[model samples]
Target: MNSTLLLKKLYKRNLQPVLTDLKFAIALLLIIALFSITGTVIEQGETLDFYEANYPLHPALFGFLSYKVILAIGLNHVYSTWWFLSILVLFGTSLIACTFSRQLPMLKVARRWSHYTRAKSFEKLPLSTALEGRSLDQLAPVLAQKGYRLFQTDDKLYARKGLVGRIGPIIVHASMILILLGAIGGALTGFVAQEMIPSGQTFAITNITEAGIWARPWLPKDWLVRVNRFWIDYTPGGTIDQFYSDLSVLDKDGNEVDRKTIHVNEPLRYKGVTLYQANWDVAAIRFQVNQSPIIQLPMTKLQDVNNKAKAWGTWLPTKPDLSAGVTLITPDLQGTFLIYGTDGQLMDTIRVGGSSEINGVTVKLKDVIGSTGLQIKADPGVPIVYAGFGLLMLGVVMSYVSYSQIWALQVGDRLYVGGKTNRAQVGFEAELLEIIDRMAGSTPSLSAV
Candidate 1:
C-alpha cells in the first residue's frame, strides 16, 4: 500500500507535470519544424558520392556541414534518424498527457452543473443581477427557450449550453496524436524506388533508393510492371511539353492485370503502390546500312555544353574495316536525326525510314527506342493522416462555439441571476439581457433590480 501511494505521488508530481507542460511541448514542436526544414533544404536519400561532390570539405556547406558530418550525424536521412523519431515519440506522448491531464478534467468540470444557494455567490460572477418577485418556475421556461439544459431543485437552478465547446480541445489533441502516429507509421513502413525501363521491357520492383527498416513487406512481390510504349509531346517551339508511358501491371503468369497511360502529375496506383512518371531518356537507335542486317546500337546521353539542351548520340560503322563511321545525334524523339561524316562535317538530316549517304554507304534510320523513368512508392499511412486533418478542421470549428452557464437561487422573494461564458462575452451579455426581458414580459410580477 505504501509503495503504490509513493508511485502515485511520483506520477502526479514529476512525470505528469513534465509531460503536460505546454512550454516543453512547444519547444519540441519548434525542434521538429527546424528539422523538417533542414530535411527539405538538404537533399535526402542521396549517395555518398553525391554528398562528397556537393558538400565537400574544402568548401564545406555553411563552413561546417561536410559530407563526413552529414554521414556521421545521419542528416542524409533525417526523418528516419533515431533522434528525430525519438523527438516525434516524445511530442506524441506530450499530446496524450495534455489530453488526459488537462482537457479531460476540464470537460468533466464543464459537464457538471453548479447550484448557487446564496445571493452572495452570484455577486462574484462576470454578469450578475437580482430580480425581485421572481420564481424558479418563471425562469425555467425562459432558459429552456434560450436552448439551455436546466438542472433545478426547489430553490436553486443551473442552466448550461454549448457543452461541446469544452470537448473541442480534447478532439484537437486526439487529432494531433493521430497525425503523429500516421507520420511515424509511414516513416517506419514506407519505401521509394526508381526504375528506368525501356519500352516493351518487364521488370519487378528493385533498386530502392530509400526505405524504412520494415519496408520489405510493403514492396510488391507478386506483380511486375511492363512499359508498353513511351512517347513525348513537343510544343511548337521544339521544346518538350509532356511525356507519357503506357504501362501494364502483369501477374506472375505474364497476364496483364491493369494498364494506364501516365504522365506528369498523373500516376498509376495498384495494390498500395504508386508509380509516377519522373523522367525519360533515349535508349537505343535502330538502323540498317546497305545490305547489312538491321542493327540496334545503345545511345548515350551527351554532356550539355554552354547551357545547351539535352541530346543523345551514337556512332555507326559503315565500312568492314571499321575505319569509316558516321555519328547520329538527336535532341528529341521527333524522328529527326543529324548525320555527321568521319570528316567532322554535317552530311545530312534525315527522319525515321529516311536514308543518308555517309562513307559511300546508304544508312536508313528505323526507330529510336525511348526509356521511361518511374518513381514508385508505397506508403500505408496516408489515409490516417487525411482523417486526422479532417478531424482537426472539425475541432477548430467546434471550438468557436460559446459555452455559457447561468445560475439562479431564490431567497425570500429575492432572485439572484448570474452567468458567464468562455467566449463571446458581449453576445452572452446580450443573450442574458434578452432572457431577463422575456421573463419580465412573461410574468407581470417580475422586475429587474
Candidate 2:
C-alpha cells in the first residue's frame, strides 16, 4: 500500500514537468514547421562562391545571411534533426497520456446509457425542442425508425444513437500519434543516399552523413542497386517531356534480383528501399597528359632544406610540327607560363591552368560527361502514417456528422416533450419549438405552450 502511494506521488511529481516539456516541444515543433514553410518561400543549399559572385558588393552579408548555413545546420534536412526527432517522441508520449487519462474515460462514460433528465436538460440547449404527445410509446417507435435508441423510465424518456461518436476524437488523436511515429521511423529506419550515376553504370552506396555505413544491424546487408540506362525526352516545343531510368537490384553474388523502369513520378522499390528521381547534373570530363623527362636539381648544402624546390612547368600541343611549344617559365611560382618556339624563343605568355595558344598549334578538349542524380531511400514507417491518415479522415467525418433525438414525458393527461442533438444545439432548439407547435396544433409562446 505504501509503495502504491509512493508510485502515485512520483507520477504526480513527473506529470507537471512532462507537461511543461511537452509544451516546449510543441512550440519548437511549430517554430520548425514555420521555418520550413518560410524556407520554401526562399531558396536553399546555395554555395558561398555562387552568393559571393552574384552579390559581389555585399559578399560578406549575403554569405552570412544565405541559406547555406541553415542547410549546414540541417534545416534542409529538418525532418532528420535530433531535436525534431525528440519532439516526435515527446508528442507521441503526450498524446498517449492525454488519450488514456482523459479521452478514454470520457468515452467509457459516453458508451453507457444516461438518465432521461440528461435529455430533458437539453431542452434549454440552443438546438433543443419540445413536443406535445399523449403517449411516448407512440413517438418512441418513430424515433427508432430514424435510428435512435429509446430508453423510458416512469414518465421520462431518453433516446440516443451513434455510440461510436466518442471514437472520433480518439481516432483523430491516434492519427497524430501515428504520423509522428511514421516520421520517426522514416528518419531512423529510412536510409537516404544520393548518387549521380551515369547512364549504364552500376555502383554501391559507400557514404552517408557522418561517414555512416549503408547497412546497419537493422537493415539489409547485401542490397545492391544498378542503373542500367537513363533517358531524357523533350517535347516538340522544346520543353521537358519526360525523365526516366532503367534500374535493377542485385543479389550478394552479383546476380540480378529485380529490374524495372522508373520515371519522375514512378519509382522502383526493392525489398523496402525505394529509388526516387531526385535530380541530375553534369559529370567531369576525362583529361590526360604525357610528361617529358627533365633533369632534377640537387639541393646545395647551404640551401634552406625547408624551402620547396622550384621548376619550370609548361605544356605544348601534341603535334609533330615545330610551330608551337608552351613553356612554363616558373612552374613552382604562381601560374606563370610562356609560349615558345622549337628554337627556344618566347612566343606569348599565359597563366598556368588557364587556356592559351601560340603560333599555329591548336588545343582540343573532349569527352564531356553527364549524370542523373537519384535519391535512394528505405522506410518502414509509411504504413503507420497511412493508417493514421485513414483514422483522421474517419474521425473528421464522424465529428461533423452527429445524431439527434427528442423525448416526451407523459403523466396522466399532461404531456411535456423535450429535444436534443449531439450538435447544432441552437438550431435544434428552434426547430424543436417549431416542431412542438405542429404537435400542439397551435402557435407556441414562451409563457403559453
- Say which candidate scores most in lDDT: 1
lDDT of 1 by residue, 366-430 (tens): 99999999999888878788889999998988888899999999998878888899999889888
Which segments of model 1 are wrong by more than 4 Å? 1-9, 305-309, 320-323, 442-449
Specify the highest-TM-score model's number: 1
lDDT of 2 by residue, 1-449 (tens): 99999988887688735753656647756865775684475433334564444434444445564444555565545666686677678767777777787778877876666554543454564333343434665556656665777788877777776666767878877888888888787767666666778666778765443211223643557867778877666676644577778888888898999999888878988777778887754332222233323222211112135434433333444444634444434322223445566677877665534444445433322222335678766667788889889888988887675556555667566555655567776665665565454443564443211
Error of 2 at 407 (Å): 4.4
What are the clashing pairs of model 1?
A: none
Model 2 bad stretches (over 4 Å): 1-7, 10-29, 38-73, 117-133, 210-220, 234-241, 281-370, 403-407, 430-449
Please give the lDDT score at residue 363 for candidate 2.
37
The superposed Cα distance between candidate 2 and the true structure at residue 340, in angstroms, equals 18
| TM value for model 2 | 0.67
